[model samples]
Target: MIWHLIAAVFAGLGAAGVGLLLRLVSGKRLPRWIVPVCAGLGMLAYQINHEYSWFDHKQTQLPDSARVVDVEKGQAFWRPWTYAFPMTTAFSVVDQDDLITGQADGQRLVQYRRYRFRKEYVDQVTHQAYLMNCTSRETVPLAGEPPRPRTEATQTFTETDPLFQVVCQQE
Candidate 1:
């Protein structure tokens, strides 16, 4: 965070320098407000670059075995530019190295951790381990509690799903 702040400040200063150069070259013909405007634009440019590079930055933080399963793009009313072109705001990834597939009581089961990354006011990353019943498409959070059976209609474990693809394809 501190590094980002320092980079933003430097970007603003660099842009202000350009404005200063223009002012010098123009021999005071350019308005006085140009410097500030250029500085502000520089700062905003830095921020935009930071926001758009979030996915790549997060990817670098993950292990080599991790695979991104899906990405979600969204538009924010506050960010009007996003309305014209949506940006990747969130994504889900599953680590292939952590995947464990086996059979329990004649039912296929798999255990893996899912990593979710979100870019917002404050970038957030979360990881949760799950025990999944491949046969019934049920999942239970493996957080020191008994495995509970709950059917999730939206979560499909078929070969088409990336999670299934990553796990089943390895075998």
Candidate 2:
């Protein structure tokens, strides 16, 4: 966070310097407010670049065993430009190496961990264990100590669901 603040300050300073240069080149014809405006633009530009690069940055930091399961792009009212180009605000990953598979009442049951990443003021990482039936495409969080399957919390995944495809495809 401190690094970002320092970077924004430097960006603002560089832009303000450019504004001063423009004023000098124009023999002071440019308005006095130009410097502040340019500084603000520079800071905002830095912030936008940071926001757009967040997904790629997080992806690179993941372990080699981690496979990206899903990506979610979002747009906000504050960032009007996102209406045209959405930003990746969240994503989910499943590590194949963690898979524990077995047969359960003629069902192919696979257990794995799902890591969720969300970008906010700072990056947040949260993970949960899940037991999925590869045959029926049903998933339930392994929340309790005994890991009982509850019907209410069970979610069914379709064929196209990336999480299902990745884990279910495995033997």
Candidate 3:
């Protein structure tokens, strides 16, 4: 966080330098407000770049075995630019190396961890564990709460959810 702040400050300073150069080149004909305006724009540019690159940055930090399975794009009324073209603000990934696959009760069972990444005022990361039947594409969340005895016997398949594809695709 401190590093980002430092970078923003430097960005503003560099833009201010450009403004100063323009003023000098124009023989001081440029308005006095140009320097501050350029500095503000530079700082804002840095922030926008940081926000947009969050997914890629996080991907680069992941281990080689991790695979990105899905991305969620959204638009906000407050940010009008997003309405025209949605921005990727969240995503899901699975670590192929950590998956455990087996056969149980005539069903193909897969156990793995699902990671969800979301960008907001503060970045949020959520991890959920699941036991899924690859054959039926049914899922039972194994996060936070303990599994009930009946949950293992019955399978629930939610249609059209990308998570099923992500989980069932694993070998």
Candidate 4:
């Protein structure tokens, strides 16, 4: 956090220096506030860059074992400015190993995550228990139980108890 502040400050100083240099070259009619205005704009630009790049920055920092399941983008107030355009502030992740097992009871349980995109705010990850039920029509037994052609849909859901909770419930 302090690093970002320092970067912003440096950016502002650099802009101010550029403005001052331009004023010197122009040799006349330069506004005294030009340096301050440029500096302020540079600071604002730094903040905006930080805000917009947050998601990518975070993704870059995650461990390779952590796989991103999904990403959601939306608008948020605060940071560079309250009325700024929308940005991505949340995402979901799952461990690569979790995906190997089709069972929900294991570490592969689906998880939901949200982030507020603030320096002080921490990302939140929540385990989600999906309630699923087998349709009666889908459970019809095969004649003679010889074999059936497998497809993508076939491997997806099984004919287990129609109603089942994915994530275990807290006692």
Q: Listing every candidate in turn, what is its Cα RMSD in Å to the true structure after a full C-alpha superposition?
A: 2.5, 1.6, 3.2, 12.3
lDDT of 4 by residue, 3-68 (tens): 878999999999999889878888846987898999999999888888678778888977675555
Model 3 poorest ten-residue lDDT run: 143-152
Between prediction 3 and prediction 4, which has the larger TM-score? 3
Which runs of model 2 end up more than 4 angstroms from their true locations? none
Off by over 4 Å in 1: 105-107, 133-144, 152-154
| Candidate 4 residue-wise lDDT at 100 | 22
Model 4: what TM-score?
0.57
CA error at residue 98 for candidate 2, angstroms: 1.0
Give the TM-score of each candidate: 0.83, 0.91, 0.83, 0.57
In candidate 4, how many Å is residue 103 off? 6.2
RMSD of 1: 2.5
| Two-way lDDT contest, 1 vs 4, winner | 1
State the local distance difference test value for candidate 2. Answer: 0.92
**In candidate 4, where is summed lDDT lowest over 10 consecutive residues?**
162-171
Q: Model 3's lDDT to the true fold?
A: 0.82
RMSD of 2: 1.6
Which residue pairs show backbone clashes in model 2?
Answer: none
Instruction: Candidate 4: give the clashing pairs.
Output: 133-162
Order the candidate numbers by TM-score, best to worst. Answer: 2, 1, 3, 4
In terms of lDDT, which candidate is strongest? 2
Clashing pairs for model 3 are none
For model 1, residues 1-171, the per-residue Cα lDDT tens digits are: 888999999999999999999999999899989999999999999988887788888889889999998899998887788888788899999898888899999998888888898887788889877877777765566664554444452355666787766655676
> What is residue 114's positional error in candidate 1, in angstroms?
0.9
